[model samples]
Target: MMAATNNKEPQRIHPHKFTLWVAMGSIIMMFAGLTSAYIVKRSQSNWLEFSLPFVFWYSTATIIISSITVQLSLKAFIAREMKQYRTLIGITAFLGVLFISLQLVGFYNLESRGIPLFGVKSNSATSFLGIITGLHIVHVLAGVIAILVLFIKAYFSKIKNYSSVPLEIISTYWHFVDILWIYLFIFFNWPR
Candidate 1:
C-alpha cells in the first residue's frame, strides 16, 4: 500500500468561527429532520393545508434588512467608524425584535383563522409550523442577544480591542438565520 504523499498547506480559520460553523451544521441537520417529518406526516390523513399569513412577507423583509444592517455594522467597525457601527448594531437589534414580533403576529393570525397551533383542534401541519418557527425565533433571539453584547461592548469598554472577530461572528450568524428563515418561508409556501 502506498502512503499518501500529497502535502498541502491547511487554511487557518478562527476557532470561534469554526465552532459556529459546526453549530450551524447541527442546526441545519435538526431542521432537516423536522421538515422531513413534516413532509411525511403531510401525506397522512387530516393534514390541514392553509395559506401562510400575510405578515410572513413583512417578517421576511425585516429579517433580510437586518442582515444587511449587520453587514454594514461589520464594515463600519472595520473602518473604525465607531458611531456608525454603533448605530447599525442598534438598528439590527431593533429589527431582530421586530422580526420576532412579526412572527408572533403571524401565529396569531393563523390561530384567528381556525388554524390552532396547539390544542385538540390543532392539525399536524400547524403543529409542525409552530414548532419549526418557534425554534427559529429562539435562534433569532440569541442573535439579538449577541448584538446587544457587541453594542454594549462598543459603548462601554474603556480599552479598545479593535478586533473584528466578534462582529464578524455575529454577522455570519445573523446572515445564517436570515437565510434559514428564507428557506423555511419558501418551504412552507411552496405549492404541493
Candidate 2:
C-alpha cells in the first residue's frame, strides 16, 4: 500500500491581494454612483457646458504612458533586471507627478473661464468635474507613493527573495487607475 499523498492546490491569490480587490470593488461602486448622478443631473436647466482644457488631453497621454512604464517595470522585476526595473519605476513616478501637474493646469484653465469648483455660480457640471477628477488624483497619489516605496526597496536590495508580489500589486493598482482615468476622460467628453 502506498503512503497517503499530500497534494495541495495552488493558492491563486494572496491575502493582501484579496484585500486590494475588495477595496477596488468598493471604489468602482462609488464611482458608478457618482457618474450615475452626473448623468441624471445633466438634464437640469442650470447645467453648464464647457469644453475641457487642452492640458487635460496632455495629462491623459501622460497617464497612459505611465501605465506602460509601470508594466515595463513589472516585467523587468520579474526578469530580475534590477537596474531597468528601477529606471522604469522612476520614470513612472515622474510621469505621475507630471499628470498631476497637468491636471492642475486644467483646473486653472477652468477657473480662468470663471468655472469655479464651488460657489453659488458653480453649476453641477463643473462641480462634478472637480469632485470626480480630484478623487482620481488622490488615487493616483496613492499609486505614486506605492511606486516610490517599491523603488526605494529595490534600490536598497530590501526585496530579498526578488518576490514579485509587491510589484504585481502595484502594477495592478497602477493599471486600474490608468484605466479609470481613461474611462472618466471619455465619459466627460462623451456627448450627452
Candidate 3:
C-alpha cells in the first residue's frame, strides 16, 4: 500500500504577537468580569444613573482616527513609503495623545457635574464607570507608547528597509483599543 505524504509546513505566530494576543485575552476576561460585576451591583443599591461625559465622544472620535492612521501607516510601510509611513505614524501618535487628553477632560467634566470619578465619594455606578474607563485609558496609553517607540525607531535608525512586524503589532493593538472603546461607549449607553 502506498501512502501520500503531507508537504505543508505549519506556520507559527511570532512570540511577541502570541504574547500580545494572550495579554489581550486576559484583558478581555478582566473587563468582562468588571462589567458583570457592574451589572450585579446595579441591582443592589445606590446606583446613580447619569449621562456619560460628552468629551468621551470627542475621545472616541480621536481614537477612531488614530486607528485609521495606524492602519495607513502599516500599508505605507508595506509599500515601502518611508515618508508616508512616518507621517501617518506621527499622526497616529498625535491622535493617541489627543484621545488621552480628551479622556482626562471628560473625567474633569464629570467631576464638575458632581459625579465622583473615583475614591470613597463614588457610588456603585459611577465607581464602576470610573474603574472601567480608567483601565481602558491605561490600555490606550500602552498602545500610544508602542506607537511612539516605533515612530522613534523609524526616524532615528539608519535602516530604511525596516521590518513591518512592529507596525503590524502596533496597528493591531491600536485597533483593539479603539474597538474596545466603541464597545464600552455602546455598553454605557445601552438602555436598562
Candidate 4:
C-alpha cells in the first residue's frame, strides 16, 4: 500500500538561527535604551557639545568599505571561488582592525581637546561617545573573529559547500553591526 504524503511546510525554526535572532533583538533593545538615555540626558543644562574627531569619519568610511567586502566575500563563496573568498574575508578583517584603531585615534583626539572620559571637564556628550563607541568596538571585534575563523576554514579546505548557514549568519551579524555604527555616527554628529 502506498502512503499519502502531506506537503505542509515545517513550522519550526532552526534553533541556532532562532537563538541568533533573539540575541540580535536583545542587542537592539539595549542600544535603543542607551540611545534613549542619551537623548534624555542631552536636554540637561550641563550638556557639553563638541565636534567628533575627523578619524571617526575615516573609520566610518572604512566600515562601509568592509561591509562591501564582506558581501563580496559571500558572493565569492557562493560562486565556489575559494581564493577570492579568503582574500575578501582577510580584507574585511583588516578593515575591522582599522576601524578599531581609528576609533582609538578618535578617543585620543578627544582627550587632546580636553574632553577626557572621566575628568572633571568630561561631560555627558563625551561619556556617551565613549560608551557607545566602545560597545560597538566590542561587536566589531567579535565580527573580526568570525571572519578569521571562516578564513582559516577556507584555507584548510574545510568549507566545501557554498550554502553554509554559518556563513550567512555571520554575514547578517556583520551587516547589523555596520548599520548600527552608521546610525550611531549620524546620531552623534547630528546638529542640535
Candidate 5:
C-alpha cells in the first residue's frame, strides 16, 4: 500500500467571502450616501410632514432574528454539527424572504397612507425616505439571493465539510447589514 504523496494542502477557503465583503462594503457606502442625502433634504423647507411606514419596524425585527439564526448556523459549523448548521441556514434564508415581504408591505402601507413616493416631484422627506428604503430593498434582495446560494451549497451540494470561516464571514456581513437597518430606522423615524 503506497502512502498518498503530492501533499499540497487543499485550498479550503471559500471564494465567496471576499466577494461578499466587497459587495457588502459597496452596499454600506450606498446606504451612507442615502442617509446623508436625507439629512441634506430634511433641512430644506416645504418638506411634507409624514410618519415612516410601520412595516419598517417589523422588518427590522425580522432582520435581527435572521442575524441571530445566522450566528447559530456559524456556531453549529464550528461545532461540526451539520444538521443544525443546515437548518439554521434555511431559517435565515426564510427570514430574509420575510424581510423582503415586509418591505413590500411597508410600501403598500405608505401608499395607503397617501404618501407620495414619485421621483423628485414628491415631498422632500418622502422622496428621501423612498430612495433610502428603495435602495435598501435592492440590497435586501441581493442578500436573499446570496442566502439562496448558501442554501444550495450547504444542502444540495455533496460538499459535507462545513468550513467555519465561510460561515463566520457570512454571519459577520449579515449582522452588519441587520444593524445598519436598525440604525436607519431609528434615524429616519426618530421623534423630533
Candidate 6:
C-alpha cells in the first residue's frame, strides 16, 4: 500500500504580527512594573504630592494622533496605494519626532519648576518619577528609531510586493507604547 499524503497546507503566522505581539508584551511588562512601584511607594511616607506636568497631557495627545496616522498608513498599504502609504509613513515619522520633542519639553518644564524629571534626586518620589519617565522615554526613543528604520525601508527598498508587514508590526508596537504612556499618566495623576 502507498503511504497516505496529507494535502493540507501549513498556516503561516505572519512574522511581523508575532514580533508586534512580543514587543507589545515587553512594553506592557515594563510599564506594569513601573506603575506597580509607583503605587506601592505612593503609599509610603514622604511621598511628595505634586501636580503632574501639563505637557505630559499634550504629549499623550500627540502620540495618540500619531498612532492614528500609522494606522492610516497600514490601511493605505493594504489597499495597494503606494503614494498614500508613503505620505502617511512620512507623516507618522514626523509625528514620532514631534512626540519626542514634546516629551523633552515636558521634562524641561518639570525641571524649570524644580520637579526633577531628568534626574532630580531631592527625594524618593522624585527619583522614582524621574526614573520611570526616563525609562519610558528611552522606550519612546526606541520607537522613534523603529519608525525611522521603517521610513527608510519604505523609501529606499525596491521590495514593494510584500514590504508592508514590517510597517504593520511597527505601527502596532508604536500604538501599544502610546496607550501604555496614557495608562501611566493616569495612574500617576490619580489621587492617593
Q: Each prediction's TM-score against the native?
A: 0.94, 0.93, 0.94, 0.91, 0.83, 0.86
Lowest lDDT block of 10, candidate 2? 154-163
Residue 45 shift from truth in candidate 6, angstroms: 2.0
Instruction: Kindly provide the TM-score of model 1 when superposed on the true structure, using C-alpha atoms.
Output: 0.94
Could you give candidate 4's per-residue lDDT for residues 16-127 as a string of tens digits? 7788889889989988999999999999998988889899999999999999999999898888887898899999999999999999999999998888976677888789
lDDT-wise, the better of 1 and 4 is 1
TM-score-best of 1 and 5: 1
**Candidate 1 Cα deviation (angstroms), residue 19:** 0.3
Looking at model 2, the pairs that clash are none
Which residue pairs collide in model 4, if any?
Answer: none
Q: What are the candidates' C-alpha RMSDs?
A: 4.4, 2.3, 2.0, 2.8, 6.1, 3.4
Show pairs that collide, candidate 3.
Answer: none
Q: Which model scores highest in lDDT?
A: 1
As a whole number from 0 to 100, the lDDT of residue 52 in candidate 1 is 95
- Model 5, residue 129: what's the lDDT? 75
Candidate 3 ranges beyond 4 A from true positions: 1-6
What is the alpha-carbon lDDT of model 5 when measured against the actual structure? 0.80
lDDT of 5 by residue, 30-91 (tens): 88888888777777778687877777888999999999999988888788787898899999
**Candidate 2 Cα misplacement greater than 4 A, ranges:** 1-10, 157-159
Q: Could you tell me which 10 consecutive residues in candidate 5 have the lowest summed lDDT?
A: 159-168
Clashing residue pairs, backbone N/CA/C < 3 A, model 5: none
lDDT of 2 by residue, 5-61 (tens): 879887688988888999999989989999999999999998898889989999999
Error of 1 at 109 (Å): 0.8
Candidate 4 matches the true fold with a TM-score of 0.91
